[model samples]
Target: MKNLMFFFATALLTITLTFAISPPASADVPPPPVNQVLGLFDATIDFTGADIDREFCQQCHVGSQVERHHALVTPTFGCFECHTLTDGTFAEFRECTFCHQTSPHHTTAEAQARHCSACHGSLVADYDDGHYIPSYATSSFTPLTGGVEPDPTNHPGEYAGGCKACHMEDIGQGIASNATTHHGIGITECSWCHDVEAEATLSIRKCEDCHDVNSLHNIQADSDNDGVITPGTETGGYGHIGANADCYGCHVQSFLAFMSTTAAEPTIPSITSLSATVLTAGQAANLTIAGESFMNTSGGETFTPVVEITKGDNVVILYPLPAFTSKELITPVPATLEPGNYELRVKKDAVVSNKMTLTVAADVQVSAANLTEETIVITGSNFGNQPGETTLGNTLGTVQSWSDQKVVVLMPEAVEGQTVTLVTAAGAVDNTEITAAKATAAVKEKIKGRANKGSIKTKSTK
Candidate 1:
């Protein structure tokens, strides 16, 4: 009876070992639940909607275990993946310090460099300075894509600034104005983003991302008191002026460092042509200069352009004060210019353009001459709006009427082969004349021996 009882016990033990060691009867047989204590896990934490935060993690991990995830792996695993109480939200990144000692996560330079990749490798895969993860204290900033992708074509350098510039509380005033925490990253504390060994010169070259180039904050105030206000100036060209809040509260220091380190290539102004080659002296001339990159807005910036006219031993600078465009500038050339040859050029700040030749010639030209009964009408250009004087070969003619293009003077007591001359404010000159009459001595004798020096006399209105 004892042997039979022992045999049954051995057989029972054998059957138990076989069941435990055997493979599943079929692949369809469902595997065990991922969690051993599935019932307790379900009862403790609701996998559905819940406002989860750092305090909520304590229920399972107890004290520090809540923050014990590998710091390097956290970004990949993502706190929200398991902190599953909230959807699309993670505990403030500052809470990351509870378990990971950021003060000295990696001791060596090589190790620290590698350490930087653990968190930033995935976040900045595309060099997107705008990448951000919302904190439990704040809702996720929407459309998390479309951040500034700095490259050689757009934003030449690594100008993402730092994570705190847009993702930290109090500091992220540009786009992360609603940010409640640091989102787990410190801008200055991270050796990779800033030079913790020295005065923490920023590595990614930020601020211009959201403020100047991005057109979001458009902070173009002259905060540095330099009097020059434009994008890429000494203060990153984004000042606190007119800001709804103190925009410089965080940017003042970082931006100064950025400008000092990076050199922005100025858009040099160019000159293609000038509208007029000759300008009248003693008369204002509207001169239009065509070019590229002529800055006019908020004038007084360093790149403001001015026209420089240089004569043999003198120079005249003209500013297009009232208004101008990037492609053209119409400025009144002062009447003060003397009659002479001059070299004209456009100067943008200190950059000078190619020289163009301009002549300030005597401003007068004779177009035609006609003889009316007892008067000679001289038609030409630049005949001074105000009446001047007219002469006919050693004889003075009585001025009948005078205008810029047509000047009529009573016929002088003259004869054939005589010359007619006009004198105006332009200059004392005989630059214009009428052809001598072909009439014979008999015709000259008919009218007191006077022959019209130009066209045949018209019938007298008298």
Candidate 2:
């Protein structure tokens, strides 16, 4: 009886081992093949083999899959992550629309039409001529499908095919469905009807048809995508179309007529000259800026004229002056500017005028050793090119000549070694050590030399 039990246990162990070593029932099936054109697996490549791994599938499929499939698949996602294997058969992976039905372009007809301006702005302008419906209705126009000619007698407005007769099927049902019903069709469905080569050729022809080759309208085309049409030599050397001509928005109008009637914007302010080009540093002076359009007379929120003084690339000082009439603006020079050669420019409403040189000179110096009775040369920087007052002690002296580096002044009746102050439009510079004794000593030395020469001549004569 014990021996029979031992034989039964051995038979049970053998059956259990056989089941564990055998492969799964579904392993016999093959995976779908990889579609080379679509770059996806489609019911042909074998996936049920034990040797097939996720890395094997990745070797063939790479990069972005968003254009084909909206969902992104990275290296981490295995083939089974998106595609499920149901009862040994791989689930079919369809196109992007299979999952995401309502994309941005398919949301509404208005949304699609609005997106067309990103590429086909010129086409949209041509369609606004109020002749799109008539153009499409003409019997001479060829339909997209061959052998079926358009019947002008059966013209239906915004019904049946409408714009879709020639345009692709992806352009929404008809023209009436979109927000731009009056504006006509856009190029949202361009890829459905034309290839890349055809699209390039059609774009050129569409722009040329309305604008014409070498015409003012064509030369001023916004082909550079700068949001404004740059005026070319054809338009009398006008720079920016926005500043030169007014189209009153983008409507069908005579370009020449608009250019003739529309007045160009006021010319940019220019700096012809400045009242004082050089001035003493840290002194307040009234500076005059001469230029055209210095004041903004056109009513509204008035723009205050500003003076910008810059040293190299850095802005040293900016003074905002009150509004004034005439072609000149008189403003106070700020006292904060240090001694340097700076560029002064006038700015109004963010437009900078021409630049002029302005020198902020260092402090003045008086030569106490070289003081003369008639003339005293005061050496200083930024002593402007005009004569000014010079005060010796309490007496005011006459300015003989003045320059950026030196000022010559006629001395007044005053004690020697007294404080002398030179005052100009730039401001005042005071020196306490200027002495009249230096002039007296110089005169005595000259007189003594002449007396000695006379005595020597008398001795020789005797």
Q: Give candidates' CA RMSD values in order.
A: 38.5, 38.0
* Alpha-carbon local distance difference test for all models: 0.40, 0.38
Over 4-45, each residue of candidate 1 has an lDDT whose tens digit, in order, gives 100000111010110011111211101111111100111222
Model 1: residues with Cα > 4 Å off, grouped in runs? 1-266, 296-302, 365-462
Q: Which lDDT tens digits does candidate 2 get at residues 120-227?
A: 222122223332222233242221121122344675321111222221122221113222321233235553233456534333233323222222122121223332
Compared with the true structure, model 2 gives a TM-score of 0.29
Model 2 misplacement above 4 A: 1-267, 295-304, 370-447, 450-462
Task: Enumerate clash totals for all models, in the order shown.
Answer: 6, 10
Model 1, residue 7: displacement in angstroms?
99
Clashing pairs in 1: 93-184, 158-204, 159-205, 161-206, 219-238, 444-449
Error of model 1, residue 411, in angstroms: 21
